[model samples]
Target: MNICRPYLAKLCSTLSGGPVVSGCRWVSNGPRFPFHSVKDIKNWDLDSDHQILPPPSTIFAPSKGRRTRHDNFLDFKRIRVTAGGGGDGSIAFSHSAVQPFGPPCGGNGGRGGNVYIMACKDITSLNGILNNYTAANGTMGSSNNMHGANGEDMVIRVPVGTLVRQVQAPIYASSTAAELGDDEGGVEAVGQDETENADEDEIDVEEQNEIYAEQMMRLLEKHFKFKTNYRPREDRARWLMERLPPKPYVPPPVLLDLTVHGEKHLIARGGRGGQGNPHFVTHEIKGPAICERGEKKEPVWLEFELKSIADAGLVGLPNAGKSTLLAAISNAHPKIAPYPFTTLNPYIGTIDYSDFWTMTLADIPGLVEGAHLNYGLGHQFLKHVERTKVLVYVVDLAGKEPWRDFEILQAELEAYKTGLTARPTLVVANKADLPRARSNMEEFQTKVQYPIVPISAKERRNITHLTGALRSIVEKAGAQG
Candidate 1:
């Protein structure tokens, strides 16, 4: 038997009531022929397969804890986006050797880049999306009345069934108010000496952090909600050049969405270029030198959610042979185990027919009793089947009350959506090879209202008949849709 070094020392200490540290050296050298007490263990002869004095190892070691790993399949993401800013207008005079003092020749500023969102059919999730996006800024204007080049536009490609919406931004580490808003999960203490020595103008740390957060919010709304191409005129002075977020900037709500493949939507537009000083060169103002500055853009928040698209969906309770049936019918190699909750993510597989026609079937994670109330990631599992044309309920015929499972499944779907139960569906009675399955099916037939098809997914029996039935149901459902 293999034993650890720590275990030997503890055992020796408990046996002879001596210092365990001294006996630790007993395990350092080979175990030769013994002629004395426990101290003679170091002198014992060692061999390749020593029975009593083998090599020390950790095979029987003790540990404080164990860590369980979970695979991640990202389907939702929150991002912060910012559009590009406009270029500044230059002020230069056309000078020459003969005519030292010439007319104004400054160029106008260029417009900033824009942000676009597109739906693509290839992608299935938002795992590759970044948490932040910022468009390029426009170049500055120069002499010879040449306008600055516009910034490059960016396109964000998402899954075809993605839903996007603008929302409140999270607390950033760089913000001064992060101390109050961040989830630090710790208690704070204030010393009397420090508070008494501080000035009255120095606000309390909490109050200061709150004020900083409010100021940061106001600043973002003032800069990010810049929809206009050019800056608006100020009320105080009509003649002077003004900037965006006019004196009293009021924050407005913003959001958007795109669903169809190749569908595009503009999240933010670039700023407009400033006018040159020559534009003001009139009869009254002979030589104007004033120019406007380029407008700046700020960051905003957006959330992206993805839903799986398929022609048919398989639904059942945990360990109801859904994954097995999918693997037998299609080429999908999903995780299969004797325990419950083996399949954590939704998998889609394609089935091919003799005539080269193909069909897609999605294997969704198992649903629990309280699936409609969001138990055990129920909401996520249920949403993946919403886009399917047909639903296939796989029931475990080996169970004592198999018919009750069908009723529970129907109730969950009905609770999730008003008219979901009315959709076209098929009942699959799996595990027909098991003993008592036939008798159970007979009892199940009396309770259930729909027709049940008995089959053994492990043995692949009745799979052909099942596929033929699914083909007609899918065709009809697709035509109606």
Candidate 2:
């Protein structure tokens, strides 16, 4: 009849080497029970070696004959651009019948091409622009003092809210070493000397020479390894890897903010064309056959990042019915599954209220604990919610701790940016059709001060009421803004 009696009997049975308990397992010759106590059996390790098993190969291994599809929703891109070089000036003399060798008639060189980036609403990502872009060179000047044609400018189109920044070119070490072949000849000459000395004192001189040669080789190898592999550490690859600021590092000031559509920013300017030889044919130096060369073009590296803009955003933890509610309320077809973090990217959907009013709702990827510190999807997609006027908090009523989920979500938003929690918020209790949902909802209401709207997104129950409530909140927020 005693509560402790059953547990004591089970423990005695396990110690006596009877049948193994359901929760605990046996390891060979290591310990009677691997776990520390009976309460810790739930977190027991069955593997004797205690090595963690990796994910299945079918899930992690790359498949043959399959190509990864290009992601069109990329928010950031780094590109290297080389502008065209200016054309060389022409040096020629006029050969006319009336006046042969007429005043230095050489034409001027053409200007190099310029690179420009413009923001447009039609584009949604930077995937359309290739990694490397080279502009066309200008046409060379001709005889008879004909002016050279100017190069056509290159215009790159990107999505609105794109920011462009110029980055410094990386410096690399020279591939040719100053003392490359010095050790080769010395080693060969030493070997020859050792062979000659071996005949004189076969045992003593041979062993000494071999040992000296081995020590010399080791010293040379270490010296060369340090010089070739370690020195001049700032290579192109390493420079690129460190281009972005690390976590907790404040971002550098933006060079250009392309928030407006059709806004253009000149990232790289073209070199100016040189003056023709005719310009130098002055009174001091008449008929001078000298023509200047065009200036050289400079290299440019640009970083582009896109931030999405929406009227409202749905924020919640993973598998909290955010995607389901979004799909039910709007025309957006975001991927929805029972697994966590199903939606990897932000999905914007338009919600129409009546014929005149409509609002855009962004369904961002789920946020976990430490999201403000850049954990689990991180602050990458969190910026997309900054411009939202109204915030929708989605919670699963059938979850183990529905109220705690709401608090964690709010804490993440506040930590990311202040005044985020002060925005007009709407609380949604999803999955209300579940059996335990009603009881959990009652507990959630007593703990939370905000009004909650209970709706079953899967069954499309109470959807109309939820829509009306969200529309009212959004409209008020817009008016206040």
Candidate 3:
């Protein structure tokens, strides 16, 4: 009888739904068999010579795709986050019999909100950006010296391993076309004087260049200060100066781009609001009471990135009890089932040790053969493996030729990414409870080249051995690094 064939049906159930329960039967003197998930009650073959099979283990993924697969759990490419603009000061007027010309009724404007980047690892994608509030313009300053309200804040979350780059708006050299146009217009007005003014235009261009250079230098000095002894006051002053547009060459605008995994989000921040009328006071309206105008909002861009850090990955074909092992070892409770592919997604678990020590384990989806070629949902499963230092290849030992199964899995890994197979790998032969299991273990040891540890995820046998082995590998990798 094909030993691994009975478990295949159960694998389908696990992938789609939950665990399957099946009767277990073992025969002495025959090949040692472990758990299985066989459905038909009448097919049990309860004769004197027959044994029953356990329900099938769950499977993950319809299988196919090695190349890919992030934030709000919503995928967005870009979003505009506009910080509230500063309110403009108001100009108030007050005239009394005793005291004329009321003090300038102008009040300081409110500062705009500053964007920030916070790091979080649990976030896998940026899908949350779609549901977030769009940018809001700053409130205009009120009359009688009231500053305008600051804008509300917008916080964005991105997955780990993201890289944030400030994308600057393209710098356009002020075109000489303006001067040419002015010359042409002047020629239409005065043809003979046009040539003479050409020299004057050249002189004006040079003067403008000098002014631009000076303005740029002043802007830089006001905004950027790097010295051995830097004071906070000067730093704040510099910050304020930098936000103010440069005198001539508007400092090239900056656009923030956040790249998470392979996805990129360009254009993150929002626009600034217009200023109030308080600064427009003149000598003619000299009063003691009437106040100033409102403030303007500022829009800026920002980026978000994600970084994933894990020490080990518990990987295997679907229904190999990867999630069960994770649940047994860590606080994570991944869906468990009897059929194949029970887990559709990856679940992260933390393993705690003595003295406040701990490590992380990522239980990724199952990968069949040809995962590297993106066959059988392999690509999405493979990426999570990239960050892990060690790979725990979990295998169900009761199935037919578990050792051959291990080899096929290794081939798939090597095919998908060349260096993957070379990484430190541990072979875990699971389901060691049945009568025929011992013989299968012996056969596996003789056939396989790497170290193989036997355990039963259902019976909780030899789990400590696996944990110790994993910890040792993790510690060794750390020390080596």
Candidate 4:
């Protein structure tokens, strides 16, 4: 158990003219310097697991190449979740050498797995979620009356502040299947042409019963291919009990909002297992031969919408320097460019104050003039700011009409939602270093009613005053709420 590093110990022994301690190999550094200096210990083992690194020339490319694009950050997505199906019951009788014929000993099947959804703070986007999810199937029963094993349940974790809503639509599309109902699974009306063509109101009680009886006869024939004896009244009664269908899948009435971390909700429930042959043994009948079939769960469609939750939101038009302002204040690296529409998605950043207090902010994509009417990057990015306690507007002081841009920005927000502009707000006049910025700020101050703060984000000037003002507003909002 050598306490010193392998390279250090080797260096010590080399200088002192003493033998090196070979046992120090256990405490050596990994990957890069497993056995530090190959030339120092000149015995090169070519076939060892630790190989030498390639030359620096091969690692770095000489010429510049076109960059590859990455997938966009997804905040809204849809998924289909299907629960596992129940296992079928067994139909078998125990037989031993002592007794030629024994009583029925069939086992019942196991139920399917359930699906759950949970909210986690670690997850930030919906891009990782799958388009479809299917749970494991239950095992089949055995002849010795052993029950089947249940399927494994599935849990899906998503980011907090997610809204889950079940999509409303018909589970099945075929005319025959819809006529028979959702729980039938093609068994209620196997030959469904007559039932689908005729109107339900016109068909009386007697005609409906007659049509159902005919369908049930066809169902039995399809289920059993071989010739069997189900003619007796007792046998017929036992056979009908085994094919009972599961209940229909019903959608949730209200939308599910997961605001807190670690919150969970059941999205889909599995079907119940079928009954075995012995379960049908009544006083009138000594032994029942029929066994129930397992039930299959229908697939449900759901939509997940993730709305960002932050203390303040930065809103502006394209090339208005909102992204630049966010980068200067907080520890967030949002993409910045001179052209318009540089930010493709909303970016979140946290500002750590000196007193251990912190404020979170989101940089939303630029809003176009007709953004409320679905012109460009419409309400998609607008909803991300709905949960903020304050709104921060960043306007370009270098523009020809700075005050007109401010009024249009406020109008767009008001159009999206009725009272969105009524919250605590701040206006920022960015690019104060430009030639016309000083004169524009004076005219803009007179036209605008809100308090205006002038600062050059590119130069990183006067940021302390802006942050102090924001902290006071945030503190006031926190106290009132």
Candidate 5:
């Protein structure tokens, strides 16, 4: 007579292919168990009247350790946009005492919203566009030939080197109870087969039932515990639920690059408004009641990728003191650390050689051995180097292998993109104050063929000389271009 006893009995009966309990209906194809498959348990929505209850749990819970703020130097982003639909046209007539049947005075509908992507110098990252963008719809036309208000246009601002590409939106497939019901029928069939060989399959049927029951309970308990611990809100919960196993695959297409600042590209065009009844009042027909509806807005997806632009680029392996040299010669304040890969993003600084002449220098994150293969923040860091006309290879003299490090840096650059080694290059031997650095510098000078500048970045030794050499090289490169 216990409420739980009835549910358990029903479950055993369904699994054993036995007759259902009197006055009991199947909630689904199988027994009405609180915990089923991981997918099923999360989506389970029991009726309020059902007495036999499931353990308190939620199907959706937010993922742990999700970043709340946008990354300041994010180079890539995928955004979805929904342009507003055009407003409907009105078919109202003028109601005045002067002329009873005056001219047909229906108004035309307003145009829909448009989406534009613009490149700007002030913005450095795609972090500002974290949320999906949407535009407002136009207002409906009014009486007396009054046109509807046009929808507002949305302008998206990206970095100067950003490339915008149009891509198709991702489609998510939903799983239904009917799909899971197949498993129930299979279990029932197995149970019926076991009954035919009662004695031989008795233990097998019991074991199978126990295994399924344990699996169902374990999945329910795991998710239920997570839901209780995280206690995520609706939005976060939904985000987590969507990311559950079997993620969707969406491949974006390649599109044109937007490199110049103040450049504008139309990503989505607004829908056209429909004409009012007055437009249909032609010579052949009088007072036509026909009116067209506004066109529907089309949604679009865009991919934004940023590539930093600079006249000069500083490249080196991790912990090679690139940031220190950048701070010494330019006004940029990149994070200086003794650790590897400390600088996660690129920093741009301008050096003023004269009142009218100034050059921009970009300090990118350090590269590693397999940088070309996307190892150690390689792709993002190396991408910024592509825009630089001159390259300065910063090497740590104190590390005892400046030559090998320089070779590796050059190899990575060449591997990622050709013609980088052919560009005007300078070798800067940093950390010259160290005891062994002076000895290493002597060896580096004898082996390297390019111009070598030895200076202790920490002590600011010979920094002026290094900057002068860089300015001269930049000028020569500019003149050649």
Candidate 6:
């Protein structure tokens, strides 16, 4: 406990408190102790009220009577993308000073720039800058057998929660929805009789409409004729709904922008350069230099949108050991210390249940009093939790009253969004290493009538038990579904 005081102090110093500042001195000499730059922590303000932090639409909500920005402002909405094309090879001849007899020389083209979306645990907020993004291909080669410089590649940065989808590939009920438009247009034109006595024009219009309709019908037959459907009407509707474009991943019932983060989609990309004529002027042949061809252009449209952040979200009051548990259970390496509200964003970790079943867990930022009303850091981090299927509430058993902690958290969740309480939940008690934790754990069990497991994440105690229990619960839900 003496050794831990300094670490605890450092955590408090990072937070907005006096006690934590005093505790940090002991940790200064410890090997595992961390000293973070104040700059890194500037983005986070523990004292800020998040729940009432301006209702995602109010432009500014008062924090201690001062106006503040919307909670979702930190959430990114835009991400631009660009790809590089191959560089053109230069065509030149090597002429000796004496003989001056060299075959045509053409360098090979530089390979096209490859693009990738690397998975990261932190660094979300892609949706914030998705707008105004662009990518370009590599340049063509020069004349003196020098290959043209390759175009610079543009990588589309996105949060870990983002999934890439092609631009608006609408799957129709069937390709041939009965050739409704062409025939209907002709019928309407003929019926209107706007062109009086113009029978020839009407006949031409009729023939043209029939041809257009036939072409459309043929295209549909060619593309969708082989498709098969096995689902019910409701399932079909659901599938369509799934395919339907999302209405921008906004905080539910918030005033985030519809124009910038809305239905916009990428339409086209820059074309690749044509080949230079150096391969045709071969020595064996008459002209190997002229035989080479330029690369073909690849113009494609791409669309990306933010999806739900994670499947399971870990939430609760401050100092609940959310970060410790996250680091212990998965590869995620969130900062952990004996303090509240250590995490700012929703940290993600992948929990592999089996070869076939793997689910992601989100360590949502800690909640405090009046979080939903934007009372603290809770409001800023609450949106990330909205998409989770399961909510795990971590309670500090040793620090304070466990049942009161639970009640406070319940109130915070309800205040933020009413539906959050309805999600599947598990109440967990942390810090079992402390002597006083057991009695508090038992009391919580009796009062809540739900199974409560006590654990010490820092000590690595009961970690396996906690993980096994979580797996059982998650898998059971899957089975029932």
Distance from true location, Cα of 6 in model 3, Å: 59
Question: Could you arrange the candidates by TM-score from highest to lowest?
Answer: 4, 1, 5, 2, 3, 6
Question: TM-score of every model?
Answer: 0.69, 0.66, 0.55, 0.74, 0.68, 0.44
Per-residue alpha-carbon lDDT of candidate 5 for residues 149-225, written as tens digits (9 for 90 to 100): 99999898888888777765665311332344433233345555655666654477667675544444333232222
Checking candidate 1 for backbone clashes, the offending pairs are 31-44, 31-45, 32-43, 32-44, 32-45, 33-45
Identify the runs in model 6 with alpha carbons over 4 angstroms from their true place: 1-74, 77-131, 135-157, 160-308, 352-357, 479-481
Evaluate residue 357 in candidate 3 and report its C-alpha lDDT on the 0 to 100 scale: 75
lDDT of each: 0.73, 0.72, 0.57, 0.76, 0.73, 0.56
lDDT of 3 by residue, 161-190 (tens): 544544422233124333334311221234
Model 5, C-alpha of 11: deviation from truth (Å):
46
After superposition, which runs of candidate 4 have C-alpha atoms over 4 Å from their true positions?
1-70, 97-100, 169-214, 217-235, 238-246, 249-254
Candidate 2, residues 100-139: lDDT per residue as tens digits? 7576777877888888888888776677878888777766
Q: Encode model 1's per-residue lDDT on 1-481: one tens digit a residue.
A: 3557765675455334455566464332322322334454544444564424423341234554543221446678989888888877766678999978888777888888888889988776687788888888888778878888998998888987787887876756237455546322211212333345677577678875554444443433333222235332232122331223343232364444455789888887777666666665667556556455567676768898777778889999999999999999998888788888988888888899999888989998999999999998989888887887888989999997898898888898889877887888888999999997988988888887775789999999999999988898899988897
Candidate number of the best lDDT:
4
lDDT of 4 by residue, 1-481 (tens): 2323654565544333455556533332322222335453443332354432334353334655443221357889888888888777777788999966787677887888888899998887898899999887676666778888898999989988789988754455345446765323444544366667888787787876666665565554433221156533535633653644534557564378988899998888876666667776668656677666666787777899999888899999899999999999999888889999988788888888999899988898898899888778778888888988989999999999999999988999999999999999989899989999988988999999887888999999988988988888888888987
- List pairs with backbone clashes in candidate 2: none
- Candidate 3 stretches greater than 4 Å from native: 1-80, 85-104, 107-109, 121-130, 135-137, 142-146, 157-308, 354-356, 414-418, 434-443, 446-448
**Global CA lDDT of candidate 6, please?**
0.56
What's model 6's lDDT at 352? 65
Candidate 6 local lDDT, residue 78: 28
Highest TM-score: give the candidate number.
4
